[model samples]
Target chain A: MSGVKKPVERRLRGEAVPALDVARIRADFPILDQQVYGKPLVYLDNAATTQKPRAVIDAVTRYYEHDNSNVHRGVHALSQRATEEYEGVREKVRAFLNARSVRELVFVRGATEAINLVAATFGRMRVREGGEILLTEMEHHSNIVPWQLLAEQTGAVLKVVPITDSGELVMEEFERLLGPRTRLVAVAHLSNALGTINPVRRIIGLAHAQGVPVLLDGAQAAPHIRVDVQDLDCDFYAFSGHKLYGPTGIGVLYGKEKWLEDMPPYQGGGEMIRQVSFKRSTYSDIPAKFEAGTPNIAGAIGLGAAIDYVQAIGLDAIAAHEHSVLEYALAAAEEVPGMRVVGCARAKASILSFVLERIHPHDIGTILDRQGLAVRVGHHCAMPVMEHYCLPATARASFAVYNTREEVDVLMAGIRKVREVFGQ
Target chain B: MNDLRDLYQEVIFDHNRNPRNCYCMKGANRTAEGFNPLCGDRLTLYLKVEDGKIAEASFQGSGCAISTASASLMTEALKGKSLEEAERLFQAFHGRITRDTGGAAPVDLGKLEVLSGVSEFPTRVKCATLAWHTLNAALEDKGEPVTSE
Candidate 1:
């Protein structure tokens, strides 16, 4: 009972306005100081892409300046240095993911490409014509479209797990969807559009119990929550660097070693092959089999630096701070007349998607932008979710560690302006 | 909020609140659904064509003020015009909204010309033009190609 009380106290205190050193964090991101439309920028689009910190930018610059050479093949000193730095990122990613081996970590262009790799290599190898692929209705287009393409190519049936009105996944229905024919379960660890932190660990366990593999799309979760692939025991996990306060055009895919070894190569090129001949070419092992061409060397190094930055701040601290911001924004947003907060899931990240009555989301975004407040307006690439809610689109204000309660107040005022302008 | 006045002109908000011609024709010759997934704007365009003339036009859907009002304005602009005239109007409206050239000279879009301000907000231009895109799609069977920017 005493332990339970401690958790409850923390949860209650978590809702209180966080004492975030906003000045210090804002100093790290130089982009926050600029003026948009003669107003100081208030960026609330962290879910779309996070702004890069000074450390990440410096890391990228340093990579190009000092370690500018080809990786793995060059014999020169610069090449060796570059190769070590490049491979060192893989090791850092392995630790970040809590993966068993560096061999399990494969770098791709982004989450979309990572999922496509899995769908092409793993899906083609393991999934048969009549096999079933389980997905949820709340998935982003990245998570849904790749599997749909695979299903179309392989003649597999795609089964969708329904979502409740609150945007939580229907676990009972998901269980019913799983059967002997289930070959793979692809799901997002968090819904980018709704801010729902899904029960992926339980979902993975259920899939494994049925002897089916699971792929977790960690694009939205990696930056906000503590993720341990070993603890979750998921077969594959994918995430993008841009969403995690790192550089764009870089992502990582972590697969179980056994599965990685079993799947065939996704792309064919110079680095992915062990030995090449005119007649037959043998592919390299695990990660190299997937990373076929000249990779984003500077991007990878920047991502490694980004991981270091997150580690310095601590994920628990970030999560707690963001949770407080989300709670405050949610409560304050409800105070505005004609404002309805969309995606009211019990377990959510720091995303507030909403609509003002009689006002379109684009109108809300435009009005907010005039106030120097930046928010995303539209379906957010989750069209099915929009269709589900019967909304044309929602205005979303997503927060990161750099955001402050004052910014949330600005967002609230923007909503009031929207109500006033729309005469609601 | 310096130009908050410019962002929400009274005309824009009025059209948004009480959009005209915002309904479906019961026996329209053609209808097409258009969606801008990014902004969650969904529109269904219904047209009544009689003898190569757009006898009636209406739009039914849910979207932000820019899109809904734009749809309402589009229907009003196209009604009672010959198919060729409607196509030319659609082109002029597209250019006016997107800030492109080669529209029907300077002064074609009378009341619809207020939407020329939308070109300044690059993102909302898509919202303003979604209805017109759906209209073009519905008007395809009239055997005239309608181009939208």
Candidate 2:
């Protein structure tokens, strides 16, 4: 009986690296194969930005080489090719998110810009004076500041749902905060500083029950887990391509078709407009209405290739491999004296945010960097989460599909070196 | 390894472990706050100036070994020094940590020379210089917190 369930047991025990060939996956990212400070580089900063795969790089290069032209409004062959490739990426992102239609996805500069787009258009329309925009304590600054700007403009109040000591959102607080005055609920799908996988589905359900629309800040979540906008029923969802192994300066804002039809154009320019007059000007449809000028054509095409790459390998396999590596890192951290892992959510992704007793995270970062280990050491643009934990900063070592247990071991050794250097 | 050791020398660890004059002054006339929002290093510098010379210097805050040690050693060095001399010392300290030296004679910073290793690690130079910038603010009575953005 034990032998029969061996494979299943191995997975449960977090020995599931065999789900995907990490060694072969690592080879796809050329930047991972290098040295820093005479030591082999162990990149653990995926939460900041991921290294691009050859597929993504080749896609961007191919766009520049073959089909470099202004998209739309051009009668040339290259223009048609460019426009098709750019529009094809929108379809790819639409299918990736399992949205109802390609009309839902609007490409912006990144998740930050996506949130700002919603705040400028949807938020300005729905939120009124004295109405509240509810958010959680664990949101990144990008999620918070945009709404703050909106509140400042419209006299709307910002209500916060508190989190537990374990970094999980207090559902009771969220329920209490969700009231008649709530206009929109914007929260992180996954906390970047703590790696907490928030109960966004339940949050969405609670908000929808109150007839309040919800927008998910999926900057950290989209790259790790499978996101279905239709299943979650979130009014809007935002994520960055750079964090998802695609090019920078490009992201997606997935909005429902009904809402997209109602909201005004985020920016006014050439492509977003249908007809312009001296007195009156009309705008384009859902996506083109949001996309104002010539967009990041190569970036969107690269994101398309990125979607193809991840889909070929499968997100489930990637998630399983990262889970095992995170578990191994957590276990290995036990041996390091004074080591404290900050986020202890039962459901989490692959980020390991921690702090050493009496040792500043910047020092830890510098020492680890000397050993060719790259980890983010700061508030991670989530200062409110740091304030919730009563910490100034944390040293974070985040994992990705290409990360390995062996790299985690190197990180452990580097952490030990940090303590030794500090004479702890 | 060598560069890391150079940057994080024994004196820096000593100063970090036992930061001197790490307390808010009760009767201070000149004061300034230093903040590095990126790394979350923050400190309040207090100076008791009498007759163009520093009578007492103290600070209280939290930072990494580099910034904490620089502040600690700075308070110790500023005691009984003339205002002009302190200005010279700040310039010398800043120059030492930022310039290449290029086989030229090193600036005479006394105990503060321990931080000269910060030149090898470009990112930590701001850590080493944050306190001195705050000192300049204190001297000028800037009335606003100094930020190393």
Candidate 3:
């Protein structure tokens, strides 16, 4: 554990007071101020789902407390208030991503559904038989399975861009794979398992040069780094709100306005129809046409509160504090005897995945759990990455804004104990 | 972490470190593969049964210590037992880990009793029984893969 702290201290350079007060930030997340397994909870499973801050929780509670009504169709005051707040989130997301317009942002269940919306609709509408859908091996199953389903339905081929042993994408290989048969290139902006931040801006530019569209699975990126969909100029981007410390059952799919207008609606229901007759029906508009049913009104409003909360703390400050934790945790984890860190990409983010010698990750996870260190120990919905590394699974520790350097020490101590019990 | 110590007993650790009957039996007539996709635990359970009686038992795979040790102990106890006896032993061993027999082994299970502490860890019950499940599949002569879903 001392080895872990030394590297972090070197990185910190004697600055005890970080730019963002993590202790003050920890207070906002009430769930953090509790105990698990008779020990103080050291939650490091942010990549799976983050704990909601008080503001996001209060926003949901306040909705049920006062503004409990449906949106977009009612004449009553409660309905109007609910409608305004719900739609207000769209504008907030629009600004958050620096998207061109609110018409481009559509809310869905999550990143999985958002990808499926594009697959089922845009994929079903435009993807030709024998066309190729190129993806990297590091993408989550949510990103991979949708395209595979699309391939099965359309007889289109699914091509993959291989990753280096260090978990970074091979740019030359990606460029070579993008040929005439390639219709779309879909890739993750940041790997959930490896923490490898792909050169998405460069990848998007390469795809655009070939007149191909691209979709960035921003599930792991949106929470940890700055995302400018406009600057990147991606045709489509998807992310979930629950991972961003908001509510579940809510996410955003930002598509270029032209693409959304050109593609057909995903689902058909009351809200999406402009008019309906026995003979024919006409769709309403881009976003409403996509979000057909009565949406999770409370979830969307709560997501709006989350965006406001993150903005107040600022993404830059949150990222800086998390980066410190990452560097410190890395130095500590490397000190574990025979410890093998899975992903060592040159540029990474708030995740650290590793395995101890002679110890299965499941045992390691169980031992860590007994010490109240919550980590995700599985394929992480990215099984190909595991297969690529010839591993069944790896233990992952992902940090967030509220995490402190001390928590990393606790994690290292717990890992050392794992070795002690195993006698390794 | 007393529970951790109890779960990873010295005998279990010894067996995991040097598993007994860890091989594919050459004259084995029955074989089955077991897989726990979630944990990436896969093993091939081989049995040599002649005239409805067990002749030999062995297994090969990779998994956590609890699972590896469980398979090691299971194969050792299963040798020289008749088919009916093997079935009865499986019931007793499984019941011990699952705590279905009022938290006590109904019969003397010998070395297999060390794994009784596994019942406390609900998530690891499948790991302890994965080899046994594969053994059941081999005895049935289904020759298909088994899953710990």
Candidate 4:
């Protein structure tokens, strides 16, 4: 049994260190090789952006090579091919999130632009003076800054739902913050800095009882867990493609068709106008209305390929693999003296953020990089979350499908060296 | 395991362990807070200038090894230097870190040249320069408003 499981153990060690024969999967990514500082690279910063597989890269190349043209208006063969491929991805996203209609899916630059679109358009239309926009303490700056700007532009009041010391959302406080004055609730599905997977479904249900809309920032969640917008009953869901092993410059925003129709167009430009006489121009349909200018044609197709890749691997298997990796990392980190895991919530994705007792996170990151291990060390664009925990910054190591348990052990060794250097 | 000595040279680890001149100057003429929001590095620089020369220079804050070591070296270097000399050093140090002039320019950063390795790590350039930027702000002699880098 031990001999048979040896290969499996190697895969679980997150050791894609260029010597493994994990061919079917390894062949898909071409940029994994090459040297950094004369050592093979160990990229553990997947939460920032995932590397693209050959399928995603090839999909982008194919579109440009065979079917590159403007979409929604062209009558020629290339136009028809591009439009079909672009709209086809919308359906794929709809099925991926289990959204009600293809009309609900709107493509944008990424999750940042998606949040800004809703905050500017829906916020300006529905939010009134003294209306409340409730967000959590663990929100990324993308979620917080847009609401702040919206509140300044409009007369709405912004409220925060606090988090517990363990980094979990305080549901009781969230409920208490909700009332008749609350117009909308925006919260992250999973924290980027901490791996805390929030109870968004319960939070969404509670918000709906009070007749308020909820937007889930799925940038961190969609890549790690299986997301079903219908099951969650969230009013809107936003995620970035780069985080999901797809190309950059493209992401999806899934909103209910009724809510989307009710909201006004975010930007007015070509392909979003029904009739352009320069005198009272009519607007196009929902998704196109939000997608004003030329969309990222190749990026949308690449996202479709990424969805195919995830589905082929089986999300259930991937989630299970990541769970075991997280468990291994947690246990390994515990073995290091003076190292404190920042987010220790029971319900979490595979993000392990921590700090050595006396050593700063930046020092930890620099020392680890010398060992060819990559990890993020900073506030992670979530200042309020850092403030909530009374920490300045935390070193974060996020896991993806390809990561193995062996890599977790390596990370542990690197951290032990940090402790020794700090004399803690 | 690779040699840890290469990345964390004995000099750097020594400075990080026991930083020199790590205190706040009392009754300083100018003070400014420098922050590298990316890594949550915060440092308060205090300077006292008399007769266009630095009478006292001190710092108090928390940051990473590069930043703390850089500040420690800076406080030692600027203690008695004239305002003009300090400005010249700052420019030379900045130019050395950025390596814009093919690194041939003679800034004479002295022991500070040990940090030249930092230029290889693009993300850490901000960390190494945070203290110098703050010191420049505090050393302004003409009642110029203190600013952050």
Query: Which candidate tops lDDT?
Result: 2
- Give the Å shift of residue A164 in candidate 1: 1.0
Every model's DockQ: 0.74, 0.88, 0.77, 0.65
Best by TM-score: 2
Docking class of 2: high
The C-alpha stretches of model 2 lying farther than 4 A from their native spots are: A1-18, B100-106
* Residue A246, model 2: Cα distance from true site in angstroms: 0.2
Overall local distance difference test of candidate 3: 0.90
TM-score of chain B of each: 0.87, 0.95, 0.93, 0.85
**TM-scores, each model vs. reference:** 0.93, 0.97, 0.95, 0.92
- The C-alpha stretches of model 1 lying farther than 4 A from their native spots are A1-9, A12-20, B1-4, B30-33, B142-149
lDDT of 1 by residue, A119-179 (tens): 9999999888988999999999999998889889989999999899899999999999999
Ranking by DockQ: 2, 3, 1, 4
**Model 4, which residues run further than 4 Å from truth?**
A1-23, A420-424, B1-7, B100-105, B141-149
How do the residues A52-153 of candidate 3 rate in per-residue lDDT, one tens digit apiece? 999999999999999989899999999999999999999999988999899999999999999999999888888989999999999999999999999999
Kindly give the stretch of ten consecutive residues in candidate 4 chain A with the minimal lDDT sum.
A15-24
lDDT of each: 0.86, 0.92, 0.90, 0.84
User: Whose DockQ is greatest here?
Assistant: 2
> What shift in Å separates residue B17 of candidate 2 from its native position after superposition?
0.2
Model 2 earns a TM-score of 0.97
B29-51 per-residue lDDT for model 1 (tens digits): 97888877666677788889999
